[model samples]
Target: MKKKLISMLMIAAMAVSVAACGKSTPSETPSETPSETPSETPAEAKDPSEMTIYFLTKILGNQYWAVVEQGAKDAAKELGIKNLVVTGLASEAEVEKQVQQLQDAVAAQADAIVLGPVDSTAMANPVNDAHASGIPIVIVDTMINTENYDAALMTNNVQAGKDAAKEMIRLLEEKGVKKEEVAEVAIQIGSSGSQTIIDRLKGFYEYWDANAPQTWTVLRDDVKVNDGDISKAVGFTQDFLTAYPNLKGVFGPNNGSTVGFVTGLKEANRTDLVMVGFDFSTEIETMIREGKFNVSTVVQKQYLMGYEGVKQAVELAQGKKPATKLIDTGVLIVDLKNIDNDDVQSIIKPGK
Candidate 1:
């Protein structure tokens, strides 16, 4: 009976040991029951909004700049850019005012700046500051001297000037003014410091040197500086009429000078003098239509300059480079002959 009892106790102990061995260890709580559906990757992030752009022109309230402003506005609306501040001084001579505007843009943390600099050299430091602050710059209409900018969109002034020279020669020839009979030709510039004007002058001289008759004189004194003032331009034009009685042709490379030239020529009844100028205005268009002075002018794609400048500025803001750093917007030579053509009309009336 004692042996049977001890065997029974051993059997019970073995059963307890077996039960303990069968119990499972805690296996990390089974790692959150792996979902049947695969985990999704997050979508790529989007570009931020509320991009503020500054379209700073050399001057405000001018017909040429008004068209440019319209182009910028059109682009801003198309791109969904919320803040596009188009601002500038009343005159291009206000270099300090432009510098202040640039500095203000920097202080306001503008995303990008599209500028038609008043003075290429004076605006360099402010542009440098804007660049240092990570704001991109797109120069338009007029060029700034620095390569630190993202893009430059402008009419090739040199080529435009050459075209003007050719037009002048053609008109002069039509007037029975032979190359040998060409007494003098003159140029009225808006500003001596303007790079655009300087380039135009260089182009005119280059063409003149290559093609103009040796007897045709370009008097150094006849190249007058009008300081971009229409009144000043008028004065200069009148002076040219008096100073060179045999003046055969004249080129005005800016709107102010061109307008002044037209006014002075009409006032002096010197409509026989061949004139080739830059830009177009109501007055200029009327002059061309009226057959005054056989005038032909180079019309820059101001609207394209503005449109492309904003486009490039926005692109740079969004971490993209323009297809080209320098975008030549192009120029058109308009006269009465082709003024009514669809293409010419488009250039003349850019807003249309």
Candidate 2:
């Protein structure tokens, strides 16, 4: 009888526990079944075809910018973007024209803008204004001083500068340049106002100061600004060659400047100096393959810049933030040895 009573008591306790679990407090019970879960319906995707995107390059006609244009156009086509307007100034120093273009884009109520800024500081106010107006600004190749941009796709210029410095050293060493040898290097830049140029020059100087021999020097005080004029760059190169007899290396940090150095060196009948440059052109390609002097160039993925710039702009227009504010397009140091490699050739002759 005692065993049966205990067993009955245990059964009663379990029944009470089950009854308690089955009941719900008023707050714990949902008032009613939701009409639908939040995840059941999502916002509709925006149509890129209805939007107007503007592609503003730093300058037109140069191969570097040409490749960038090609990339942007290709992306626009692939995305089925209906209205893509591509425009740029005749020169990189046309800051006022670019500024006007930005204002005009705003006036036209451009859905998004892909820009390669001519001057970092000069473009800041306009860029900020454009952003404040609710338009997305996607920068390519260069950067503006203000952080108001939606996305910036560019090469890591400072690192490229350091890489150029290292290549310059290697080329010099190949031609029997000794650490103790007294030689000077001259630098030519596209424009003084370009943050791209400024950063590159900074990287080069920083690396050289830390790694170069005491006797070797960069002409910091004599750095030349070509203002994106190849003729001016050539003239400056000639001046450097004439003034600095001990000049052993030349660094040109842009497409026009690089061509200027190559041309000036050939015109001067100089085959003893090492030349390090940026960007890839037929002139640079041929010189690297056939030129007597040591020549190399730091080539950037300019085409990728254009493609990604437009893509990011479209994303922003659709109320999406980019994965990151800045994108490093990357660089390749091409010399004679690697010039013939398939990968190197692809970069230097992207579409060809």
Q: Which candidate comes out best when scored by lDDT?
A: 2
Candidate 1 TM-score to native = 0.85
The list of candidate 1 runs beyond 4 A from truth reads 1-49
Best by TM-score: 2
Cα error of candidate 2 at position 187, Å? 0.8
Write candidate 1's Cα lDDT for 198-271 as tens digits.
88888888887888788887776658877677888888888888878788888888888899998888888887
Model 1 poorest 10 in a row by lDDT: 37-46
**TM-score for each of the candidates:** 0.85, 0.87
lDDT (Cα, 0-100) at 244 in candidate 1: 83
- lDDT by residue (261-344, candidate 2, tens digit) is 999998887899999999998888878888587999999999999988999999888777878899998999998888888887
Misplaced by over 4 Å in model 2 are 1-43
Give the clashing residue pairs of candidate 2, or none.
none
Error of 1 at 272 (Å): 1.5
